[model samples]
Target chain A: MADHTATSGTNRKVCVEHLFKVFGADPADTIRRIREGAPKDRIYAETASVAAVADVSFSVAPGEIFVVMGLSGSGKSTLIRCLNRLIEPTEGRILIDGEDIVGLSADALRRLRLNKLSMVFQHFALFPHKSVGENVEYGLKVRGMAARERREKALRALEQVGLAAHADVPPANLSGGMQQRVGLARGLAVDPEIMLMDEPFSALDPLIRRDMQDELLKLQQQLRMTIIFITHDLHEALRLGDRIAIMKDGRFVQLGTPEEIVAHPADDYVAAFTRDVDRSRVFRAQSLCRDAHALSADEDAGVAAERCEALGREALFVVDAERRPLGIVRHRDLERDATATPGDALITDFPSTRGDAELVTLYGACATGLPIALLDDAGRLEGVVEPLEVFHWLGGTGAEGGGAASSGGEGEATPASAAPSETRRRDHG
Target chain B: MADRISDFYTLPLDDWIEVVVKEWLVPNFRPVFRAVQWPIDQVLGGLEEFLLWLPYPVFVVVVPLIAWRVAGGGVALFTLLSLLFIDLLGIWRETMVTLAMILTAVTFCVLVGVPLGILAARSDRFAGLIRPVLDIMQTIPPFVYLVPIVMLFGVGIVPGVIATIIFALPPVIRLTNLGIRQVQAELVEAGLAFGSTRRQLLFEIQIPLALRTIMAGLNQTLMLSLSMVVIAALIGAGGLGLTVFTGLGRLDIGRATLGGIGIVLLAIMLDRITQALGEGRHAQRPGLKESLTRWLKGLVQGSKAYNERR
Candidate 1:
């Protein structure tokens, strides 16, 4: 496994390129029509075929949680299954740690699955006859590990999921949440470098679903496993995905960070999905922050007041030599002490927050009606979250177009659709 | 109109069947039929000798003990009393021989049927090929094949057992196929996703879950074999079946009734035990000692109540 990783100069854990999975009698003809840009419905009408996945491509870096979100029939499940060749793709390449697995022999594919990748299913498919420990150890057993060693490793994996106590019990005896934990333990036991999860929490109750999501995040933090999570829940995608790809009709509509997606949805379908999302929870301070206007700490208070008045701002940020925020200098204070340096009258107690803080958490800081300094690591002023900007983002107004246009340039590293605004306009009409 | 319809050239279906069976099958398949009978003969001979050699007291104790373990005290008592009555009827040897035949047929049925069932469950083409064959084997009257069987293998115990096996084989195969196929597709996918080989998937996941259904098939096989015994007796197979066959030939109603009674007793005992096994109740049943203690306590209490009533 390490040798494969070493051979792959790129750091991507898994990469799929131009993958297509057409379910029909004539996949070649259907694929040809699909490549010719025929609509899925027309293709189906013409060839009597369903293109479950079409021209899909994305790469997940090591330790990144790449989420593919779509509703039923959007082909998210097919796309995930293609990663393991469970449903063999009709076209293109799937490179795992730089090794193209699309052409792997059956035995080689099995070995790859045993050593490098493990899948967690939507239904928590624990073998009913096996004990929880046995279920967890199934992958290791398939890998031909010694029985005692596999059992020990299985127990350890179960312990990681807080299910060590239930190891000896049959999986049927566990509650839904506990059974999914065993499913998770089963995946974990193999210690796969990449874990493919197909809506692992979707079958769970709402409350348990949230708990499982948190559990998965916590596990990912420790394990740093490259996870490609599939879900139909937009909220779940936003909560768990470091980068999210929204799919429709077997094609990806947009791919970006949760904040980017919530702030600047690429098309109307994506916009409609984002419309229901709680922006305060998804859009962080960094995404909402505006570039702060600051004066050097040694600048004159009179000059600062003049600069603030010229800019029509209520206050100005004061920064030291490294661009680290010293404090804010209010216009009134600068005017009151016009003879002194701006730093002398700086309000050191002004509200501030980290750039990564969610907008929900900055409501109190925003309540001060002052620009909240958004600091990055080392106390540098990355940007400022203005009170108006918070309301603008939370209000779901049309002011998002400018933000969307600005982030659109940097949001995707892949060759995503270029005419998002055009598509959005067309959809709106 | 009916005479005209009948006057249309008659297809000689019966003559064709006779030519196929007598001239073609008997001459060509005699060796194959003998080979088929070889395993049945060995198993039947061994079982019959052991059952005959075992003391009556030990057989009486052991069979009821098995029933007690598998079922409950009521079944155990029924088994014990039935076997003792068969002995009192002076047909214990005949009963053992019939039991041996039934056991041997069922054994062969499982060995042949299970792999075929697994194959049917795995492949649609194989299943399609075998489905009509299984249907014919099941729906055709048992007596229809006896002549062909006797022509091929001759009149003897092995041929009789072979006929019983053919009559009993379909249920096990059909049920085994249904059981394995009915195992949830998700479980099979899980097995594959976890990198289990096809063999491992069948044994580790499919067979274990399908065991109860397979056991139901076994019980059906046993019952069908029991029903075939009297028919098998027409071919000179020795057992209680012989007793019934001879009594029927001579119009000895008393002898026929006694033989029928003995067969029914044996059938009831075996059916109860196998059915209990199929239901998987054996795992939850109380131990024999615990059941005996509880029964004794119930008997004592019953006597006290009876005395008070008197």
Candidate 2:
């Protein structure tokens, strides 16, 4: 499990090891019982304590968007708060930039918060009495920065979020989305190295939420700051996360990139979440394409037909010297003119798509009955996409069935398709 | 059965309190009570002297101007009319004395109450400890504590002011604590997230947000102190209370009725002004300096236009 994390030790931005947060009178005793393999419910019944975060560990690479995705009461909120020591861990070590913060003195932890860490809250946590600019500059003011410099930094941060004009207005005067921008500006004003966002857009309207998400991505691209985003919305997790950790009952059930998780869920709990995912949008043509066998464009028609028959393919791709696809040569066309060269029998009006095109965009091209050629940036053929591959993926059983099946068999449906469709029917019905 | 119930033993709580106050508290705590009276005496004496020395005409102008700046034209007119009527009632000196007493008591209440409130707000244990003390201070009748106050501090205006302070101190403290505690939890967390110290959180976040509530508390304290004046006059505190006290004793119904009217007028003016302050409408209204400059500018411009026309 540790190997799944992209970075290790000193190179990582934030590393949490064996974190535990038990809400009760005797956390240490409860932890001991937990380590002894007592059931969570029994322990709770006996001790009346909630183990909010239980022995969770992960490392985040620098400039990575590591998302913790979970439902309410799944402890994602507790886990994010533990990162900044907002809620102190009952027992664990949290290393920020190779220094363990769990045992730091109060002053030291405060300095760490001022210098390195900032958080954006879900409810926009803006001070109602302060103007937006004042709210943005609060962190800088706490650090005792000079007035002029703090104002400049605050305005610059507000400008980054497109809210410089509203800085003088009170937070109550702004809409929810604009208030959250002020919250973001407050986190950004200090130029912290790691930003912890706890469902920062959960209170916003869906349209505004998407805009904020896009804005965050844009800002992150320019700043390259490591971000740990917590959200209960799976779509939000898939959209913003570079890597995601799916949490259930105070523990991480699976952690992987969005594609990896959608392609291969770890358990039924994870598969249940992935089942509702829009695979056409989450997946790209590159993920579904297969290696294509090509014949030289200069080859004879009789020789191309013989090669196509040997390969048991209806048509073969013809490419030039640079591997750029020229056209498709069908076995029937080649056989019709056996004495002619394959170039004379080539069909240049073949369907193709970009390598990075989403599967939804390629569905029309796939229906042309000809295998759609996936082309790279240089117009060279990367691979070919069959119609069955697109349907299998959209059919909801492609991940479990493994990569695209090459043979055209009618009975290729596996029993793995049943549960996901059952879930889908129940959800829609 | 009725005879048995009637013969049941009693606790002798009243006799026990009388013994404690007479033997232990009053004799042993005279110096402590005197020390407490010293500051109130200085403030009350200075305020009374100052108000008496100021010409009545100065107050009739300056106070209405203040009212106009904080509230609006209607309140200012009401203040002007009320002050003129009080002046006409032939109890101006007594009204000034009562104003001095109310100011002294409220000043002490605010100074002592706000800090205690902040302390209570910060710690649950402190809040729990102070809650019942505040309840007893508020619920006990003013007359009940008057005897002990007289025994310890003696019969004077200063002791009367001290009694008023004790009677009126609870609301400010309770409300201050309540206001600070009522500051939203997320705002406190945000302050902490930004690395604010405990003191910064109190001053910058908690106090500013709680200002309106605290001001409401101040208003309550002022009204309560004004109510205590009549009771304080029973122990020889001179004020409109003394006017009513003497009038009632000598059966001069007209004098007592006039004094009562004077107290009501003062209460209405103070209530209106303080209530405006608490609502914070004054923040948007022009301040005294700004209004003066703007009025001066308008007058100069009007005269210049007249000269040009000539």
Maximum-DockQ candidate: 2
Candidate 1: Cα lDDT at B246? 93
iRMSD in angstroms, per model: 1.9, 1.6
Model 1: residues >4 Å from true position, as ranges?
A: A1-9, A321-323, A398-429, B1-24, B281-310
TM-score of each: 0.89, 0.87
lDDT of 1 by residue, B164-251 (tens): 9999998898888999999987788778888888888899889988888999999999999998977899998989889999999999
Mind giving the per-residue lDDT tens digits that candidate 1 earns over A177-221? Answer: 999999999999999899999999999999999989888888877
DockQ of each: 0.48, 0.54
lDDT of each structure? Answer: 0.85, 0.85
Each model's Cα RMSD? 8.4, 6.5
Give the clashing residue pairs of candidate 2, or none: A301-A342
